[model samples]
Target: MNKLKFFVAALLMIVAGTASAQKTGYISVEQVISLMPETTRIDSLLRKYQSDSLNPQFTYMVQEYNRKDSMVSTKDSVKLSAQVKNQIRQELEGYAYQIQNWQQITQQALQGKQQELLEPIYRKVEAAIQGTAKENGYAYVLNREALIVVPPADDLLPLVAKKLNLKVPAAGAPAAAAAPRR
Candidate 1:
């Protein structure tokens, strides 16, 4: 009974100490990358990839081919028209498939590259954040980005940057968009 009472007293003291400790700051994963130079480059590269005029050109070519195909089929060019129409249809479908595959490949490439580029830096930042919290006697250092209901005053992006020795980018920094294969 005496040992049980002692353990209970110790546990209560520990909880009380924890409850009274101070907490440091928070930042979002998005904000973290925005501050990094590599992320900016990645954004720029992807934008150029997705904006080529291939779609419009493909549509125009397909339409022109179909019109000629109908004309040739209507008179005495039946066999040739069938071959031309089939070829045009195949080309149009091929372009569509290429677009779908490009989208998937681009997404995968960016994700993999981003993870590779950011892993070491993220680890360093995480360690620095924990050290800051412990040194400052913070009871809980929460990620406001992960939480839906952080108080506005508790948004700690600036504090986290300061502690981690990282600079936040100025407003309107352009992100890179890599060009996808045509």
Candidate 2:
């Protein structure tokens, strides 16, 4: 029984050592995504949409709110009846609230459009990562941003790029910015 127990313990140690030897790599997913060509097109679309549609609406709302605010602020309350003053106050408040809400809604809509446009690009990158991992015998491919410390030469960006048939751009290539979320 002691001999069998000793053999089992030895086998476990060997298995553990082998498992720990598996290849692991990290990649900056944000950087990789930003480098994708589709990102530029998506950014262009987002900018155009903001300038053409959302901005005009936002500007109109701001102008309307400003006009109402000016009227409310400049009006002589002593000359106005109580009912008229109250109505003007409520109108000003309504315009202010709508302007605030419109800004929030427009921001959210833009973010949604950005994510929608990038979904396919993200999927392609993901597929390339998985293919590279499988071909390279990597046991783990972690996101660099999530790691406390990443060893040099452990980044899989070039490897994944090769798998995707993409040319690795210069180190200082422009990064794509995500939509504003605040």
Candidate 3:
């Protein structure tokens, strides 16, 4: 019995030592991305895409809807064939539906565009974070946003930002403003 108790105590000590050796760090990826200079350019590109491409598409859809609606309203329905009238009505309804949901459609398009533009930036940040963690002997890096009761882990933002050649605000300075959500 004494030998068994000694073995169990030894096992516990080993486990505690292993746990203590592993270092953890936390970082806010959004914060890092916000500090990246490319983010501003990406925001500008997204706005241009919305104004130049999406807006024109919406305008064309509205014009087509108006033209079809006017044809159905102003023309003599009595003289029109039943099938032709039904087809035009269906087209008008489709256009109306699209127009009604334009906001959702445009938002999705903008989000997709934003994601495409930010993909490379995300990869770059990921690489920097990994390098920082390895260089600083961190065993795990947690997302700051995901934690509520964070333990005494190192804040890896400054280290990761430096690794990426990005500037971090001085201590006690206001946190970097988050990038605009699409």
Candidate 4:
């Protein structure tokens, strides 16, 4: 009976030790990404794409819409031939459709551009995180935002940033506003 009890106690200790040995760490992914110099470059490129490409295209579309609208509104419908009036009306409707969807189109373009510019940077950050975890023997690395109870020691932001050769921001440093929301 004593032997049986001792065996069960040893088994419990082994199980508990194994569970406790698994290292869980957390990283503030957003914080680390913000510190990377490439992020600044990517942000600048996205802004330039928006201002140079999307804005001009949107302005042209708006102008076209306005021109069609003015023709539809100002032209004398009674004196015009049925075919001409119908053609003008069709043109106006097309312009209206384009105008209505313009914002969505621009927004999609912005998001697409952002993703294109950020993918490589994101990959680099991921590699650094992976390397940090592997070197430190972290079995699981959670995003800081997702964690409920995190100790300061378990935060891997500095380690990952170091691996990426970036400086970590001071604890009380104000965060820079990120690029416009998607």
Candidate 5:
């Protein structure tokens, strides 16, 4: 009976020790990315891509649509064959459809451009987070936004930011506000 009791105590102690050794931490990855200097450059590049590439394409599409519309409207329909008129009408409809959906199209283009530009920055931040976790003995790192209540010292933002050579905002400051809107 004494041996049984000793064995049970040993098993409980081992379980407690294993549980205590596992460390978990939390960080706001968006906050870290916002603090990164690369993010500002990415924002600038996206703006430039919009103005330089997307805006001109939109303008050209509108101009082409208007020109086609004007040509169809001014031409004499009585002199034209039914087949020719139908073809022109179909073409005009296509243009109108593109113009109507331009916002969604442009939004998708901008999102793709932003993703391309941000990919490397994301990789860098991920590496820093992984390295920090490994160096600091964190078994799991949770997104800070996912947690309702967290232990103060277990916040890994400062450590991760430091690992990335970025400055963290002072306590009580809204770090999320610095993040760029997607």
Candidate 6:
């Protein structure tokens, strides 16, 4: 009777172990953005904005115009003799002031919009990640980008990226921004 009881207990333990070992849980940190369309759209908009801001040819033209305008002085008749030069200088200065004001307004607007757009989306993503982890019965999760808590080797970035159709480079590789080419 004792041997039969022991055998039954051991069989139950094996069944329990097998059932609990089949987990459908994994971490997804960096690829969360790729899976989200809104995030991708916003990212593209920001990249275009940044590229427009760094326009080199336009920058050179603005600098050259400013240099010529600064060399003009209304108080000195010799330098201001050409009515055309005076007119050009006045127009350039006015345009420059307008551009400066426009840039300031645009910068403020971008800041407000970025906060408005990113904060809510970030909160939603965080909640979804937490819920997903809980639902899938994850025992542990760690961000591939911030592999500080969980064992680094257990990072699931590749899996998540593959699922989301995004690319996640290996560690020590330069980030997209730091990469030499766009």
After superposition, which runs of candidate 2 have C-alpha atoms over 4 Å from their true positions?
Answer: 59-95, 101-103, 170-182
Question: If ranked by TM-score, best first, what sequence of candidates would result?
Answer: 3, 5, 4, 2, 1, 6
Query: TM-scores for all candidates?
Result: 0.49, 0.71, 0.88, 0.78, 0.85, 0.38
TM-score, candidate 5, is 0.85
| Model 1 residue 175 distance off true place after TM-score fit, in angstroms | 13
Query: Which of the two candidates, 1 or 4, achieves a greater TM-score against the reference?
Result: 4
- How well does candidate 2 match the true structure in TM-score terms? 0.71
Query: Which numbered prediction scores highest in lDDT against the true structure?
Result: 3
Model 2 worst lDDT run, 10 consecutive residues: 173-182
The most accurate candidate by TM-score is 3
Candidate number with the higher TM-score (1 or 3): 3
Residue 72 shift from truth in candidate 4, angstroms: 4.2
Candidate 4 C-alpha error for residue 32, in Å: 1.0
Candidate 6, residues 1-182, lDDT tens digits: the string is 99999999999999999877754344544356544556667776666765676344357657766766665744553656588677777778775775667667566656665666677656765666566556556655655544435554454545545444556656676534321111
Judged by whole-model lDDT over C-alpha atoms, candidate 6 comes out at 0.59
TM-score-best of 1 and 6:
1
- Over 44-116, each residue of candidate 1 has an lDDT whose tens digit, in order, gives 5455433444345445555665665465556555546667767756765665565557657556655665565
User: Which segments of model 4 are wrong by more than 4 Å?
Assistant: 1-16, 70-91, 179-182
Residue pairs with clashing backbones, model 2 = none
Instruction: Flag regions of model 1 displaced more than 4 Å.
Output: 2-10, 20-25, 44-100, 152-154, 164-182
**Per-residue accuracy of model 2 over 35-146 as CA lDDT, tens digit each:** 6777778888999999999889888878877875666567454677778778877987886787779868887889988888888877888888988888888989998878
lDDT (Cα, tens digit) per residue for candidate 4, span 1-182: 99999999999999999889989999877777778787788888888998899888878877887875666577555677778878978887876787789889888888898887777778888888888999999989998878788899989888987788887768898775553322
Model 4, TM vs. native:
0.78
lDDT of each: 0.60, 0.80, 0.89, 0.81, 0.85, 0.59
For each of the candidates, give the backbone clash count. Answer: 16, 0, 0, 0, 0, 0
